[model samples]
Target: MAKTFKYIILGGGVSAGYAAREFAKQGVKPGELAIISKEAVAPYERPALSKAYLFPECKFVMLLCLLSILGFFISVEFSIKIKISACLARLLNIFTLMSQLDFAAPARLPGFHVCVGSGGERLLPEWYTEKGIELILSTEIVKVDLAAKSLISAGGETFSYQILIVATGSTVIRLTDFGVEGADAKNIFYLREVDDADKLYEAIKAKKNGKAVVVGGGYIGLELSAVLKLNNIDVTMVYPEPWCMPRLFTAGIAEFYEEYYKNKGVNIIKGTVAVGFTSNSDGEVKEVKLKDGRVLEADIVVVGVGGRPQTALVKGQVEEEKGGIKTDAFFKTNLSDVYAVGDVATFPLKLYGELRRVEHVDHSRKSAEQAVKAIKAAEEGRTVEEYDYLPYFYSRSFDLSWQFYGDNVGDTVLFGDNNPASSKPKFGTYWIKDGKVVGVFLEGGTPEENQAIAKVAKVQPPVADVDQLAKEGLSFASKI
Candidate 1:
């Protein structure tokens, strides 16, 4: 028997989660929409896996004994007993590090589900059930017939849809794709989903205090290395870039992070890459051979080179651009009732007047919502505004965090006190194009400061003096 849905989302990822929410908001009837995903669980906040999810789990309960007027409270930290006055005043000062074993626990399932990532409602499985959206988990769609408006699963099941959303997302690029020797050996990991995150977590436990070699200097590499180091494991990071995060980070910006990671005892071997791997009798990886003829011993290897958009399903059925399905501002493809959003959509970047495929969580959420809103508006013979996105990128490692907005083109002026060794390092960089501030990057920025930078990017006010802007640093952004 062939099942059918009025609206069918092809992938159950971050974009799919957001799209489902938008569909419900637009008054979708029960049993009218379905989300098909290979993951066993509902979509979650994927970024958490590399950061909070990999950190240690902390469990603690507190009974605050205080009055409303006194403004004093005591936590379960009574174990670190001291004078009443001292305990009350010195709490935050002494809270230093909380060892990840105390205080709040690490992120886990249900803690970081989708929608919450964008400060919206947490779309749990129950929420989907209430909305009557089918979560076809653990089912891989092996075949697609766009003209027939149908999808076939590996299990020999067929699903038909009137309006189709191709949100299959991106697949992790592994070393095996390049035919690196021993790439398929055990203990070599590439993370892109909840299952991959779980596998890496288990490896961290099984190889406690073991040596780990992180390949690639990108998001997953930097984050996974920090997680391993936090677990008291020895970490060595290898990348071919002149510095870490060469894609978006300036040399000066990369310098600060490289220094910070080194300060944390992370061995960074830049200008090199893993050429091959060697496994032991049990097929557990033991050593990673680099292109520079350097062989480093490693109990496990984590690769985070990059990802390729999964656009094969709609290969011959749609127009493509920038290696993704081509779409207009409304995320509509050449075919009617078919749309593409998230990492797989190469829609017009209205800000830049060009097509772009952003591979980040922020874009995924916004694009999905825009597509749904456009769909609903069309049904009512209304029109929605084109998606106007402000490029936003962020990452956290150890106690360091950074946020960047807008395009990274033109000349950049680095400013502020960027001393990585300082107790509180604050710094920013501005991209000047045609005497205008087109982009901004800030580390250790507060909420107000981050919003200021985002505004600066969006507005792109003119700058008369590059020197003055550098000297003013974040203040320039605030003024704009």
Candidate 2:
């Protein structure tokens, strides 16, 4: 059967969820919009996968909260509340408050749904139902016939749309791709989706306190290393880069983190790559062999090498640039009634005056929203403003949190107290390009200070003296 919608989102990911929300805001009628997702659940805050999803403690705590809530309701039904002493009453009140707080912490399905990642209201499955939006879960689109404006699902279902959104996002690159020996062995994992996080959780339990080798120096590796250490698993991280997050972090910024990780008992091996792995009789990863002729014992191995854009479905049919689908400022592709957004869309970065693709959650959201707005505006024979995205990226691990804004190019200046051993450490960096501050990175900054840096990045205040600018540090941003 060929089901049809006015608009069909090809992939139900973070971008898909945000796009759906924007469509609703612009007034979507029932049967007008459909989202096809391979995932069993609605779109969720994906960053949680590397952060809280791997930790099973959240699920455990939620169970306790549910039990407490159920008991409270049962007691109320039995009229037991009236007979409680003042001290017992106080205890019950405290329990209620704690349960409420615990209920909010679990990064489970409904708790970390769309819009919640940006601090908006959590859009539950029922929210989609109430909005009259069709959410086709667990249905992967296997074939895309853009010429016919139709898509074929793995289950042989046909979905036709008047307008199509190509938002398949990216697929994780596994070590197996490079023919790394024993990469397919059991207990070797990659964290991308919710299921991957669940598998990691199971491995963490099965190999409690066992050794884990994290391959990759990206955010995923950093986050996994921290969480695995918290679970008492001996973690060793191996990467080819001299510093962690080389794509974004300067040497000084990376130094602070590398030292902090070492302080937290994490063994970091740099300038080396995993050559192969050795598995036990049970086909589980037993050790990791590095290019340096070093062998490290491992019960669980997480590979976060990188990912490739999920653009195969529309390959050769759309314009391509910078390894992603080419799109304009409003995320519109060359084809009529078709648009691309999220990590797959390499749109013009207005702030930089260049074409670039960003694989961050913040851009994913803004791009999705901008595409929807442009679509709606086009229908009304009107036009919308171009997307002027201010690059924003942030990461959280242990007691550390950092935010980066603007471009990370040109001469870099590291400032502030970046001493990893300080009782209270706070630091920042500025990227000066053509004599102007093009980027700012701040760690452990107050909310106001973070906003100040953001403004500085946007305005790009000129800096003549690098040394004096470093001396001024965050104060320069605050004045801006």
User: Which candidate wins on TM-score?
Assistant: 1
- Report how far off residue 355 is in candidate 2 (Å): 0.7
Residue-level lDDT for 258 in candidate 1: 90
TM-score each candidate. Answer: 0.92, 0.91
lDDT of 2 by residue, 196-306 (tens): 888888889888879999999998999999989977899999999999999999999999999999999999999999999989999999999999999999999999989
> What is the per-residue lDDT of model 1 for residues 379-405, given as tens digits with 9 covering 90 to 100?
899999999999999998898889999
lDDT scores in order: 0.89, 0.90
What total of clashing residue pairs does each candidate reach? 1, 0
Best by lDDT: 2
Could you tell me how far off, in angstroms, the CA of residue 471 lies in candidate 2 after the best superposition? 0.8
Error of 1 at 227 (Å): 1.3
Q: After superposing candidate 1, which stretches have Cα over 4 Å from the reference?
A: 58-102
| Residue 316 lDDT, candidate 1, scale 0-100 | 87
Backbone clashes counted, model 2:
0
Q: Predict model 2's lDDT versus the native.
A: 0.90
